[model samples]
Target: MGSPAANQCYYPNGRSASTDFPCDPGVDDSPCCGGGLGSTCLTNKLCSGPDGNIVRGSCTSQAWSSSACPLYCLSANTGGTDLISCSNVTRSDTSYCCDHNAFCCDSGVGRFDVVPSKPQTWATWSAAASQFVVVNPLSTAAASSSPSSTLASKTSNAPFLTTTPPGNDTTSGTPQPSQPAQGLTAGAQAGIGVGAAVGALLIAAVVFLLWKMKKNKKLLEGKQRTENTWPAVYPEPPKMELVGATPLRQELDGSYVPTELPAVTDRAELYGHRV
Candidate 1:
């Protein structure tokens, strides 16, 4: 195919312009087909009355008369509509080209158009609705595409798309240096994991120690105690044996009898005082 005229048509990818995609038998159409910069696009749009009530259908740039405020067209390229064709669009008037949930940052200079506290970003829509809205006073890509060459912005110049990177002030056009988001860094995450593991081990050790201590306590409670202090009990002593007893003998035939023995008397002294 030959090159596309400057403002004629663009291919699915923004790099180059072409009329039709190369033929593919079974693959059918690519997801990147259509929804080009100048293609006819359509989707559900967010419209509201001055009372903040939702209104059906889309509003043209002229609908938002606050020319003092930054106004740019956003294309909601949601769903597979990007794969559909925009060949039917000969002009872009009320249409817009907004990426899914994309935002067009703006500043204000007109009545009731105080600099917005925050950006007016695009919201996602289930239906297909996309067009190039011009917010600046200068002619934008949408200006040539819109029907009557009319702009909604009250200003004389604005960028087609005003997307600012993080850490950069939009109005000042200066890059600021600051700490990044508070999300944990890779090393910090690793440290947290290690700390958690150590904490788990410590908790397990403490639990085991507590269990052992409880067991020891139960054992001590169940043990018996022994003490030596006690009252002593003794049996009565037997009567003193007789100083002198008569001699007796027992026969072997199961009968007890006195033996043929005589009783002896005690001698009192060597002088034969008693017999």
Candidate 2:
């Protein structure tokens, strides 16, 4: 029989008798009690022989308190018998056990069993999940449910989940219209119209400039001709002058004019004289 105080069986030599001894509710099994030679005490049913004094259960040594050890063990086995045994209990009940490897009822969407295959940045995971939910109605519904269910669904479906492209709205997949071709056509037509108008204006300006130049050249030629045609010589008007003085001789000749004495010399001289 075991000691009533320690709840552990011992041999007649006052040493531990069994290697599979159960732990006391509040007593630590490490640093096993001393006894005679060849006698041994085991810790948490995991150690054996005289040297098996260290606590070696599923939990670490620091968690060996009566309050913590059993809870740790129960939680480690939560997906199996432990959780099934505590299934009827509420989450707030101390008897309820939770699994660290599987999605627990209280764990959130990205925690516990939902952890990613490859390590993910917070932004990457959130962006991917958000896009998936936007495109998939079922995923969206699942995500809106309890955190544990959401996490479980996400983990199970991660390989098949698809995400919307960045900058695209997942709710609507409508594409935007392209504008380049239409814009280019309009711009080309406008440029051609403007170029034609400018060419016409330039031609008109050149014609006007040429007309003004020709008119000025003709006027200059007319002025040069008028200057070159001017006369070099001009005739003067006649003037009056006095004759010989025969006034005294003319009074005698008038009285003698009745006689024809001078007719002889005057005929030939007056008719043939060329002097």
Candidate 3:
């Protein structure tokens, strides 16, 4: 009756029931055979299924297809609740994608794939991350903000005009006993003048004594010369006797001879005449 019941079975819904039936054999036909979609069967082809359906394959070549296919497939098949394009997502963690590594991300699961940590190019990682902060770097309007004690300590320890010692007070007071002052004294100066006067007086006394000794020596030498030049005594003459004690005599040969001598007559006029 219906083309004598073509040599194939059919479902009650009039769909093909045999593998050898003349089917359309669309781009992704594996899901139709088993009444379930298979992703591997739709390689390089647009999905003709309903919205929010899983794609039947991976991409084979570059194409200008709608982004909805990949989004829907990721949501339905992988249970991604907040599916978004790879370019639209913002990565906040300190990570980056390198090479062809797939950026595996989850909506709120805190699971993500990233490249390994390497040496940072910037001087510090904190400096690089500070750019994303919402406030300005110079902002001082936030609550609980105060000066850092480290900076305050450094400034307090610094040398300033207020903490320096005064220069005028250094030489103000009297010196200690061990350190004597310089210059001359009144008593020592007077002693020197008195010594000079005493020396002059001693020189004058020595000169006077020497002069008196020289005068006495000259007087003694003159007296000795006068006493030697003149005699004090005179020599006496021989005495003569008037009366003859013996007759004068002449001696011949070696014998003495007596001689007659004249006599004086004034004895009493020679006893008046000659006796």
Q: Tens digit of lDDT per residue, candidate 3, span 1-275?
A: 11223323232123344432111121111111112232111211112222433222221111202111121121122111222222223333211121122332222222222111111111101234221111211111111222321112121111111110111111112111111112233344567789889988999989989898998889888998888887877667788887888979986798678887767655554346665
| CA error at residue 19 for candidate 2, angstroms | 76
CA deviation > 4 Å runs, candidate 1:
1-15, 19-201, 217-249, 252-275
lDDT, candidate 1, 42-66, per-residue tens: 1112222233322222111112222
State each candidate's clash count: 21, 1, 9
TM-score between model 1 and native: 0.25
Leading candidate by lDDT: 2
For candidate 2, what is the lDDT? Answer: 0.30
lDDT of 2 by residue, 1-275 (tens): 22334434332123343322322212332212223333232211221224433212221122222221222222222111122112222222112222232332322211111111221111101222221011223233344444432233322221111121122221222222111101123345668899999999999999999999999999999999988897666667678665756544433444443555564564344457677
User: Which residue pairs does candidate 3 place in steric collision?
Assistant: 39-56, 39-57, 248-258, 248-259, 249-257, 249-258, 249-259, 250-257, 251-257
Q: Which run of 10 residues does model 3 get worst, by summed lDDT?
A: 157-166
Best by TM-score: 1
Tell me the TM-score of each prediction against the true structure.
0.25, 0.22, 0.21
> What is the TM-score ranking, best to worst?
1, 2, 3
lDDT of 1: 0.28
lDDT of each: 0.28, 0.30, 0.27
lDDT of 1 at 93: 28
